[model samples]
Target: MRADLDIEGGVVVGIDGSDASLHALFLASEEAGRRDCLLHVVRAWTLRTAPRPPEVPPSTVPSVAEFHDWIVLRTRALVEETLPAPEDRARVRLHLPRSQAVGALLTAAETAELLVVGHRGRGSRLMLGSVAAICVRRAGCPVLVTRPHHRRAAGRRATAGG
Candidate 1:
């Protein structure tokens, strides 16, 4: 992950490979571009997804620095998918902190001008996912929770059928 030191007055957005998150990313990019600030794209993670490390001499705590390779690739791909253009994607600074989603995003928000997140994530069934809801309430900066827009098929209005 990029893991930049910190961002000041920039736009921060959290991504989780969900449609809602894609929309949030788009909105966050637009907002960041409009404000002429960096876009801090974050996808925090924990060790739960990691596989057990191999046995050592039983004299030290095992650790792996690169266990989050998939997260980095996935997050980068999502950002590229949303931003499309190479130049647009290049301007964004991606962060994948070894932390819970809310805490990571909130930490990023400490110096950010705004924080953006999806209304819900991959497995959330609520109108606003627990992560987004908590971030909205606790972020140091203004938080924007984005919901995906569903477009209806266009057709002629009902008049008469023969």
Candidate 2:
């Protein structure tokens, strides 16, 4: 995880291994490159439930560290897919925070020039996801909610087909 103190007037982006988030990352990278600033990629995770007995064994259940590791690995892959070139990757800094998505992103945006996130995440409903909505209303910096071009194309295709 990159230290928050290291971030200055850069672009902060929320990444969750979702397609929309990946698109946001791409945009954030472009913005960062244009500004000649670092692109901070943040992934926040929280344990949803405690391990229970009988149905689930403590040993069998993954630990918080394991979950964090998985998120980091997944986020890295997403970044790789978004930025194929080594030089483009060099401009990015990765962060994994153990907190809720909104809180983590809000904190990251405190000192950023711009905050970028996907319009929706893995299990979001409505056109504006809860996280994006909240961040737009409360983030310290400007927020950009990105929806992938392919998603928009699919939506248009569905409308035309119907």
Candidate 3:
């Protein structure tokens, strides 16, 4: 499987507005920078397929293109805040998909050398916060689960002293 992964080319990462996703973005960007590879940022969004209520106006319906563009802008700003100014912004490719996250992310993973995500995510499930778990288990590529920096630092201190 490792042989198939284009580690030399780059990796793909999924991000949303959630804190977990931001953390994943940070990690993915750093790895990409270090490896001199491209960072593909993919965001998944769902649009309502059912018709709206009678009271709702046709104009109220949001354009999928607008939403996708908005997400891309917001994601770019977030990434810029976290990472050093890119020598070439073209290195980062933002993909917005109008579909379910799990499937979209899994598809993205196929081309990724690695997948990075946080330990939790924003959504309800039997596990409450288990997006990372699902991705790690389902993604075709390797996944990195990031923990809060302070927690990891504290753990290191405790281990060092004891």
Please tell me which model should have the higher TM-score, number 1 or number 2: 2
lDDT of 2 by residue, 1-162 (tens): 222334667999988777788878877988899988999998877776211223345669776767766677677888987788787799999887777788888888889999999999876767889989999999999999888756774584366441
Tens-place lDDT per residue, model 1, 1-162, is 323336677899988788888888887887888888889988877777433334434566445564476677677777877788676676699887777777788788889999999999877789889989888888899999877653320111112110
Considering lDDT, which of the candidate structures 2 and 3 is the better prediction for this target? 2
Candidate 1 similarity to native, TM-score: 0.78
Clashing pairs in 3: none
Q: Write down the lDDT that model 2 would get.
A: 0.79
Please provide, for model 3 over 1-162, each residue's C-alpha lDDT reduced to its tens digit, 9 standing for 90 to 100: 011222333667777666667767766877888878898777666664222333446778656665566666676786776555666355787766666666667777876788877666655343324567778888888988765345763475366441
Please provide TM-scores, in order, for all candidate models, with all chains considered together. Answer: 0.78, 0.81, 0.71
lDDT of 3: 0.65
Score each candidate by Cα lDDT.
0.76, 0.79, 0.65
Error of 3 at 52 (Å): 16
